[model samples]
Target: ILLPLIFLEKHLKVEVESKSETKGNRNTSFGVKEGHYLVGNQGIYKVCKFLGEGSFGKVAKCTKLGSPGFCAIKIMKSDRAGLREMETMKRIKHLDPDKNHLVKMYECFSFQNMTCIVYEILEESLYNFFQKYEHHIHLCHIRVMAQQLLTALEAINSMGLIHCDIKMDNIMFIRQNCINVKLIDFGLALETKELTTVSRVQVTPFRAPEVILGLYPLDKSVDMWALGVVLASSYFGKYPFSYHTEYDTIRAMVQIFGVPEPEVLEKAEHTRGFFVLDYEDDDLCWRLQTPEEHEQITFSLTFSSGCWRSILKEELHQVKPSCDPREKPAPQENLEKTEAPHTDSDQAKMPIGVKKRKKVFSVKKDILLIGNLGNYKVSDVLGEGSFGKVFKCHKEETEDIYAIKILKYVSDAKKEVEVMELIRDLDPDKNNLIKFYEYFTHRNVNCVVYEMLHQRLYDYMHKPTHLCNIRSVAEQMFQALSALKSIGVVHGDIKLDNILFADKNSLRMKLIDFGLARKAKELVKGTKIQVTPFRAPEVILGLPLDESIDMWALGMVLACLAMVQIFGLPEEDLLTAGEFAGNFFTSDDGGNDPVFLDLLKRMLEVNPQKRIPPSQALAHDFITMRHLSGESAAEYFATAKTIMGSPSSSSSSNSSRTTNGNPQTPESKKLILWR
Candidate 1:
């Protein structure tokens, strides 16, 4: 058998040969000969060969009667192309392919009994590439790919849609001068705009445990979980959960990552018994059982290196009964005796238990105190706002200065002991936002720890004397926005107040005060408009604010930063003493800053329909100056390049072992890592 070469001839003349190496352990069939089939009655096209098949239909490399280059035609049954699926595909097609990582659909054709969609031909499937370069997949590579996928899903989700099927196979790679990947196959995509009351149906393998265990009408977060699995698989060179057959895969998902049983619920107060546990809350039950009973259960699940092992430790705790007298006895071993399980060299033994143990997350009760929450060691209070209080504090360890924001009664502080708990849980790229170190509350005082900053954009702007350069400030704000954009998050409040500078040169800034901050998926819950003066028109008009909102605020901040740079101070007409000033901090100079005026006009367009998105904002003549100067954003934010979109769920990837060396017992490993 002739093995297929990596490089193929441009002309589709000779018969293609199958490569001997099976990429990604995928099922391969190579006997079909190259031929042409009538797609519809419109025209005849030559079919070089079959590419692959999905639930949608067959995909093949075909050339039109008059066209020269090959195109990928995805043919589906015309009958299935209904209002729902077509609408999803249409939106996916219109998305900015250059900015969004979703596949670019050139066109869709429909005739009599067939529906065909054409796309730019990708050289190989992501799975194929993974198979080709399995060993070379690094955590950094996973971060880049995962970030791109997150951005794509963020766009889909922002539009209130969900991609039901996301996996290695559906991801395609565009390899040339740059590595651009596109998410393909939206046959299972569903519109979730009005799905609050409806149920969400999805595919397996890529499905989250919540979906598999009958969780309904899943949100865009389901895609987040799937992306997590894809990223984990790419890094570890295997799936987190895999089986011989689809049935086994489903069964394993339930048995291993499944929800807890009711009878096993003694002392499990903080977690919901019927739902899967989230690691973010520290209080959520990670393990279900006690130590002694953890040694008996024999079933084991496969473990790929880099897979979250801590969640497994929690699952073991749930299944094993604690030897502690207060806990119930371990569940009967009869069930395990009948089940066959997959095993690996590192697989832990399943714990046997009837009692559920309380899951612990990172947030705790005691608060750690830094300097005075209201007073800064170095400088007086620079600014205070509804979200938190900013004090210019000097670090005892680094001696490097930072402006620390002390927030009491954080938006959800009643339920969340610490604000950083949520931020840390999200695992965001910390560079864009001020880094929070610890949190402690003392007698009506809640202090959030952060790196100190030299001054705030607010202080720098209103100063009578010009200290640092303004263009440098714009560069910092843009860098922060770029970082936030990449993380699938929106900095709802991106004004002078929130932007804090680390040093007196005042060129670099970090976003602070996240009281009103939320994940990108949470659009409808909070107040639609944040800081109405500088708010985007869409937000002001009560339209759902996405990244465009950030861009809008970014535009205004850039303008203000520019004025501070050029005029040596903020225009008096724009500066206000109180926090309740109008949304747009404009000056009587009538938008006099020429460079900023042009930039802000585009960002503050009355219609979100017309407002510039982040990708476009980065391309704007004003902000692109840095890129034009041939500098990557990574130069400023050292960690920007390593940010993964988010963790799959609250579950930690690493699993801990028990005294008996059993992998499944709850009493074994301490589940320290969450998010």
Candidate 2:
């Protein structure tokens, strides 16, 4: 009788479980489990698993009874808040999801007193995707994602809605293998008209200035700002602003974008929270509050009291408000030159035959025709240097983009063109050299056209570089130098600004800016060459100069990548014969790989004849990673991660060492010479 009763209870439990799977369970608790059925108004779905959980509720992967594929069911704890999100979805339901790059909401229903919204399942969020992939997104892919996100924003804004929580996590890819993405998570979304000063929205790092400052009557621009942050984070593989606290974030914003306009600050209710009124030369202006003052007003300890304060103070000193040209007083020479020049009475007093020359005027046009080959329309200025300016231009006929370097003098341009002709036989892509297309004279300025590439290494590498990446860059640059050496040409300038990404996706770099390049035979002793920070010892000492100076500059570049310092040879006595071997490498000796140090020493040899050539440096153990203890090498590179001190501290330390007039140690010598 006991066995029969036990069997009967077991049979009843199995029957109840089967019933729950088919008919759906009426569990009101937040602990919904797998295999539980959710009975929606239009369909029934079986909970497969919980994908993620948040303060609001859990998102579960589910399969509809008759559906072909999986869907994500957002089971919200608060039915009222869930209903609000559903209403926002309904507002955008008329727009085509794929066309607008928005997440497709299939249906919404109440399941056991909880509001559940079913959305088409996506591969993953960008935040999760970036975790698995460690490199920064390519610019082309970033542009595609930006365009899709902008489309999504346009659609949402058309419906009078703002996705207050636009972030990496809120963006999802339609498929893992493709670039298609859609915007999701409208939980914090609100109508533009509904925004208030007290409405708390947005993740702190991506929060807009207007929102952070408690500016009332917000619009869709906040979402635009968040999208900009998202795109920046994607491109850089990290957030552009500080994520620690609101104060840090705002301070970074001020440092990068400058202080908000006076009119903008005047309207902000929280203006005084982050800024204070200050007088600069008797002119009133808004200045960023010191961290101490901010801490006193907010009663929040954001940073540690001791070391962080000094660091923050140094950073604050570097934060100068951007200059406004309209506010500047004219120079005395300019004021006198423009003082009612050549009035009619003064012109009449001139010599008899001297007539006022009709003021000849020249108009600069945006469109530049290149001798009937094509019309290049100039866009933004890519950069400006001692030579002249590089303008980003595209051919009007083919819309093909190119960087046109317009030289300041025709003679300088002729020399560059001559150097380019020497390498014309070699494949620019194969040789890792900038590809020159054509050179011509336009408006008395010599313009040399080349294939437009990505960013310069100087601006692109802001964070500490990885050893693997540094090695790759070193190898490519060596190959470039070898090619130039093969032709007896010396790259006079090989600084960070001269190297650019030929193909950023693959990290393929190319050497650029050959304005100072010349044949090896043309190098003259006592002639100043190379950037000051990268100038070789021989060049500074007025000794013999040759292609080996380029090797020295490349060595400096590698040291910069590894140790984050650029030791310039500014003083002649610093490189005097026996004094070059002081305690410079001793301070941070433990953090660097011995093999790398050996390579740097070889390349940076004070004797130009003994400097390692590009061929030999290419074969160095540091570049090849040959015969190295794998574990020790790994440890050294890992330790190298900490060697890059904050830029401000490094600059300050370098300045202090250089300004003192004592007999310089090798470290101080390096510091003084590089800058």
Candidate 3:
């Protein structure tokens, strides 16, 4: 049953401020305080203190008079909304709240022209818990939460009702230190048949695509979609999508899931509001409207100083719906090819083979044979690294595509194959490591097959990426490194080119190119490892290396993505026990985030013995975003813009800063295999 305790998304600190202001006006309004009694049909509850408050009103932690235990009474501002929630709660009253993982409701009553619903007291909301813990929820904990939430959803769905708002703030634990959670806040709940296009529901980040498109007669699938988002946010420790605007959310959804089906779009009442019909390859498809297009259409009326400015019909007609079923437009001729845009010297320095690769193999005619005479059709070159050229290929009988890395030398190829074999037992997707399929010799060259992934991180981060996305990348890479370290392996080459996104939408990164990988026991002193810019200080100092070197390189990768610089090493005399402490540590201008700078300092420690490990790096405040609240994260993004967008802080400058004395051009930042 629905509970009255609806804690709004505002920070807890803000709630305290509001409480103070409300206390000053407590006598003027119908505000209830400690000592006030809420009389319900079941019993009388003594108001203890406020649990939370919103526009709906305050929920008080109350003790039942003459009873031993405590309870919660939701005092809603509007009786109409309160009655609606009570009715929804009554519909689910038959189901066992404990079994279904729903918050137990006691009774509803009116007091001082307000509606108050009594409920069994629950612990803190998941939102408050996250604020206190500030770390990624373990998969095991997530699994337990997912199961209980799903059970709650199943129970609600069985009654043919939708919770409408399934977010972290709506879910609360049964008690402290317990994984069991109950679904709360069914204030927006409605029956399936009552759904409509105009119904405003759901928090922005958790809103479904169909709902955003204004689909009528919506089903329970929207609730399921929100639950998926909630789970994703819990695991990733951030919202899965950028929720700054409906346009931004839709754009991100398109990038990840592609455009919605045409039939679905056609059924949507407000499809034209966010998408435009365009012809591509002689077929019409709906494309997301640019932010400018959306703003022009939706913000046509400008109100300034009590005056209104209406948009002209001509301006509105510019983007008139072309895909309307009633409209039959004239066919247009195929567009002509245009000349390639000229690239400046700086633009030319971007990683090569990032754009569409040239088709080097005649896939339709000759078949490329690998070990066991497996007939594969080579399509195009995926990329070229220090090890060899990787080709995109399709097996004869399967539609699945695979990346075939052809090593120039069999010796290097065999070494990489050995490393791949060592990591074969670990789940590639779970560990964020490239999935190795098979390896073989073809015409004296070694070939390794892997689950094909998208472009390299180098190609993806042409501009400064969002800090949220960077955090996702960092977390995944740390998982990959942790997996390798568990098996006593080191991914010696952890450069941008060696890490690829598992998918385009989610920023699921995987570490690639283990050609330079070595066992922890095999590490030797004075051996050069990693590419130039990502090389650890210990590597340059002729000190012994281990898996910690990968952590240092990963830190460098994160620094590059954030467009920040690692301060130069101090004089040898200043280095004590290989740790950067005292003045040396504080002198580094490692951007604004102190947590990030702290993690960076640990990873970039000059002494290999003192450097942070992969496991610890995973828990670093920078990676966990522990102290960063939603508001602070937004602030961090604002600060990140100035750092990433500055011309002086570009990749070129970063390369120069990381170099030893000699500043290298962007083109010269390729992987260096120093023997």
What TM-score do all the candidates reach, one by one? 0.37, 0.46, 0.46
Candidate 3 per-residue lDDT over residues 1-675, each given as its tens digit: 000112122321222111134543434445688898877777788898988876556789999878898888888754567788888888888899877889998888877787888888987887776676555454435545655676788788889888888778888877653456799988778888886543466777677766777776666666766776676556545554556566666766565456777777788777998899999999989988877787898873321110000100001111122222123121110012110101000112222222333433222224474555365777787776545677888887775788888775667788889999999999999888899988887666677888899867777544434343554565677678777878899888777777887775446678988877889899898776666676667777777667677766665676655442223344434543345343222221123234533543453232223445434554555444345456435544333222222122123332112132211222222111110
Those runs of model 3 whose alpha carbons end farther than 4 Å from true positions after fitting are 1-29, 299-675
- True-structure RMSD, every candidate: 27.6, 29.7, 27.5
Residues 188-240 of candidate 1 have per-residue lDDT tens digits of 67677544343434444555544433444345556655665566455434454
Candidates arranged by lDDT, highest first: 2, 3, 1
Compared with the true structure, all predictions reach lDDT values of 0.47, 0.63, 0.61
Candidate number achieving the greatest lDDT relative to the actual structure: 2
Candidate 2 ranges beyond 4 A from true positions:
1-29, 303-675
Which residue pairs in model 2 clash with each other? 567-674, 568-673, 568-674, 569-673, 570-673
- Weakest ten-residue segment in model 1 by summed lDDT: 339-348
Question: Mind giving the per-residue lDDT tens digits that candidate 2 earns over 423-454?
Answer: 87778888789999889887776788888998
